[model samples]
Target chain A: MIVIGSESRGSVPNTSPNVRDMAQVSCCQLDEEEFRKCCLQLLQRSEELRDGWSWQQPQGSEDGYLKKTTLRCVSVTSKRSKKNQQDSALLIDSDCRQNQSAHVSAAPEEATDDADDEDVADDADVPACSACESSFLQFEYHVVFSCSYSSPVLYFRAFTLEGRSLTLEEVWSSIHPNFRLHLQENPLNAVSQQEHPLLGQPFFLLHPCRTEEFMKPLLQMAQQHHRSVNYVLSWLSIIGPVVGLHVPLQYFSTVCVKDPASSSNPG
Target chain B: MIMNNDKDVLRDVWFGRIPSCFTLNSDEVTEREAEPYYLMLPRVSYLTLVTDKVKKHFLKAMRTDEVEEMWFEYEGTPLKWHYPIGVLFDLHASASALPWSIIVHFKSFPDRDLLHCPTNSVIEAHFMSSIKEADVLKHKSQVVNDMQKKDHKQLWMGLQNDKFDQFWAMNRKLMEYSTEEGGFRYIPFRIYQTTGDKPFIQKLFRPVSPQGNPHTLCDLLKEMYPAALTNDGEQKRYQVLIHGIEPLLETPLQWLSEHLSHPDNFLHICIVPVPTD
Candidate 1:
């Protein structure tokens, strides 16, 4: 049964050509609380992925097929989308319900063992996690793949803000509010007609791991040397060839906070 | 003697020093022919100073021709110096004795290879000139004669209108500035090399508005010169100016800088020096 509801595109009136093509990850059947919770987890997952941590299964296991759970894919079919946008966001909800029904149905037919059902439930409860879904999506079929709802639709929109055409990153940040909204709204839509190459002007993506431990020293160093961390970090990225330093943003952030002068900041 | 690896060797020399004052305080100072004089404390990477008198006397005596070699006891261990003049002078004049300490100060130069070191206080020079009014008419005829050598379509497309003339004029102005007092001259040397291309080292440059005041320039320069520049809450306009432009940057900068007035225009003519021996 297809349930269609009123989906407001929100206050940002400008629509991205790519957005129409991006497969709409089914935001269906989820109540307000479930939707919110799913989004929160997605945001947290984005942070995790940004920090270089991969989603992986816990060790010492067997028959990983037992770990299989289904996720509902919502293909936002716009002519611009490159692939059918799959909604990994609804995978956990679907998989959990599927497993629950299976266990209920299987309980009566096979009176094999009490422990077996518990184990089956446990295996079935794999919850269609972010890492798993992403791995599955790596296969050609899944446009938007990932077990966990971390990797959302790749949304692309353009607007003139502050007298300049907003970059993809800037628009993403502005529309998403914080990382939470980004988790719920997978913006990268697949193109139905022509392949949309993801390329645009550069903008800063707020790193998930930014902590006081890192930024304080950096800010202090900036004040001392009278330089900005953004400038320094950007310079470091460019100068890597000349300076021969693998200055990733996280490392730069760490160095900045470690500066002694950072201690003087008013918290 | 030429210090093979000046920077690395200097670091070793500064950090690997013999502590004299602590030994004397422990009553471990043995009665020898020459007593230990003063301890050397570091003030900067290139300089150090003596802090104690006994270590100084020992260092002074060691420098003399009379004493071929002198032995002293520190921490109940016998130590001897054999004409270690450099260490002795460093100990006496200045060593490590600052708030941040010399080690911290020297930390800034690790990425700055020796090639960047200004060998002498001298300015280097370069010159380029645009064809004058007399040369322009003659140059046009010569251009027609040399049309076969040049890409006709490209040349015509580029010089279709007065825009090309404006560009030529602006380039002439830049050439003029480059030939002036503070301008590009010395090519960057490298610490190492794979091929001929030298890697570019990043140096920050303070932003100067067209009508920027001297005060603003100084402030911008202060932040720009540092390897790390951070934006404070206060309004500040500064940019990272890449050194040494490569052919790869041509199209990117054309799109990036837009008009010559944009900050991206400042990137042209930057020379990224290779950091090799």
Candidate 2:
């Protein structure tokens, strides 16, 4: 029973004015300026993340204005759920072949077996035979700051190697079952295709209205422990996995350094 | 009397109409030439929610196999169905000749440019999400969170059915604020500009200043978008529009948020270049 957004604000125990001011400074939410600074820091550190993600500012915009960070063509593998497999067999058999061929060039070893199975299972109960097998998917992820919510939002879209976009149902099927169950329970956290605010392109985004609700506890815990955590990294670690964008452990090790203020506290 | 004036402004904003002509894209393979569909689009309503007639009108001349999810484009740019009709018109075609000529497509739905509104339920969900977001800004979600499921539904139904009284019955509660607090915690608004690829400008702007003076629209523009305002003696380059009309710069932000906000409860302001001619 997770209360979302400002509804949960009243339930939390009241803190002293000093603590409240601390919470305001160390709160999970970021203003546009803080979001931009954190994004620049994330790009500067984390060499691996840097390879995948790039900051994109719209042309003819002044410096220090709105910009989106993008990570493109991240490959993911997920075992197709039984229902999705059945639907794919009936609806996209030919499309699967084209995608499989494209995947072969990208990953020859894994795609070969899957491609062979897809060819044979065209008329069979493919779900039963290839239940354990996985499908290769390419996903593009964008981290855009939502001004209304004052939070960074994850907008991503999954596509086949052949370039056909996955519908929302197909995306839901690809989610890790653990996160999928949680997302299913909370309708606000559900992923839906929305127009990319900057590009005006259609991309699937997890609703950001409740981001502060979910991130608050994690941030509060860190604040209490005197751990200075990167807002973008911590926030991304929570949400990235839901959409199959796993944050690498190297990111934490490489980028996060203890703050000088927190250094006085003994481990 | 102030309440009466506010009610009148809300009604005018709700009932504002843009007469539009939706023409089928010339490239669409049709059994017969499709006639251009014409309708007076409700300013506060979503394009996809209100364009069923336009879809049906064009579908008559097209083969069932050739039709895909219907999409609308103005000039060359694909119109996002998620935005309110008035926002789209004001941003792209404000100074254009009327009835606004919109190109409709049945094939090759631009997957990149537009979100798919497969059913009215999608629009409902989007609409409800927007109202909740606005409430989060206005009352810290207190007013809307206190609402029952039916109250939420009534708000949606009112907008969907175009029943002004039914909507205001549920909506007036959302627009409420304690007199001691002056107005909403923050004014829920989005400033749209036609020039850039940037979607829109949104930030936490309060209706009243810290000193308790009521902030005007000019104050918001000055803080969020200084360029939209002309410097002393400079030629006016932009026209700031809300519901196809420009309110005075001196209008209080709180009054505008209450009266001019769409059913979703966000004051959508569009800044379009003034006609050079």
Candidate 3:
């Protein structure tokens, strides 16, 4: 089941090896709606608690074993990028104002998840020599979408204040230090350059499968404890870094998520 | 599959070897009670094949008048009669060119003193002395002619001292031979470990590479888990213990072979998460 390398010997042409491994797990028997329902149910409670991440239910027929849930972490844009965004933003103010409705649904945590998609459709229309002066470009939309197979695959793209798509290479270079560990070794998973299956756009797929072995115990702990103490926050703290999604560690002080299993013991 | 060669069981660690059953207090038994007859068995015994129906051919070969039922012990655990002899060595000892120094205990002598066998310390001493004796064979057959005075003194001194630490540090070099001696001159040794509770077997390389670069037990962890190299992941490094003592990551594998690597039990790979403090 070699997936990413030159020798991709997976039996299904579209199915990757990671997805196949996920399919082989005992949890694969769970249907798409139930799968999405279970994961979102956990995060939905966390969201009500204002946990580090926000969840979105799948929109259409793209679910497999579960209605793939989406997790997003919003980060503020760098000051320099903000300045550049503002300069270019005024030039395209008309377009930026047109998509204010879509921007409202972005990062609920930041209360400031900025950016109006001024030019979401066209990459070629913008001139090369000019600077991007989009005024509202202050948010980084980091999202990971789950698959029907219960595998969490990434779907991410960043935009400027004027709504210009940031190059996948830019996102690669700007990966958080906590997430840099994966990028430094066999970095192909760092920013896997692939076309978004749904958006029909080029985007980086931060592979979460690398941590498959690392997360098994966490999942087992969740099940063995009957219910996690704070399963959603614990899950995001462990997984958010793998895909370059920045969920601040400060929110999870003692990391009591692993407590679910340890809590089972009376001793 | 049944294999006659003990080396095959010794080195093929991917599947892991079944452990030896011999249980006892110490590795070497210095004193022994005289049995009816002292029978020196073959250096290596691997009789898994069955004859006609119920009789085992290999065990039958080692039979004597008083040898009602032959068995061996380590520490104090009794070796199982059902398993083959080759696998017994594989379970207890590292793969080596040197023949095993084991004693055959007959069941007939119930109340008498048992036959003594080589312990880890005794095995280590025998190998050290054997190499010294062989050194005399080189440079010329005239004993001690090829062996220099300094080399001769160090060998006997290390042997008599019974200081496993320093003796093995010096002798592992003798165990290795370059291409000049011929291809494949090193002893094949392996250790087993489990990551957390997930048990898996993996091969540990000799401390020195063919080019002579020093390697460590840490190297074994690195080759197995590439993620261990990172700052955040470095904490995932395995903690190896031969008995209960944790061997230092910097210590050479050859030293472990002499002092800690036991034939009776597999080495444990201890997994403990890095303390945040």
Q: Choose the strongest candidate by TM-score.
A: 2
- For residue B18, give model 2's deviation from the true position in Å: 1.6
- Please write out the lDDT profile of model 3 over residues A42-108, one tens digit for every residue: 4443344443334432343232211121222223233443423442221121122212113232422
Ranking by DockQ: 2, 1, 3
DockQ of 2: 0.26
Single out the weakest 10-residue window by summed lDDT for candidate 2 chain A: A92-101
* Best-first order by TM-score: 2, 3, 1
Native-contact fraction for each model? 0.00, 0.43, 0.00
Residue B212 shift from truth in candidate 3, angstroms: 58
lDDT at A4, model 1: 17
Off by over 4 Å in 2: A1-28, A48-51, A62-135, A254-267
DockQ of 3: 0.01
Per-candidate DockQ values are 0.01, 0.26, 0.01
Each prediction's whole-model lDDT (CA):
0.24, 0.72, 0.35
Q: Candidate 3, after superposition: displacement of residue B175 in Å?
A: 45
Q: What TM-score number comes out for model 3?
A: 0.29
TM-score of chain B of 3: 0.29
Q: How close is candidate 1 to the true structure, as a TM-score?
A: 0.18
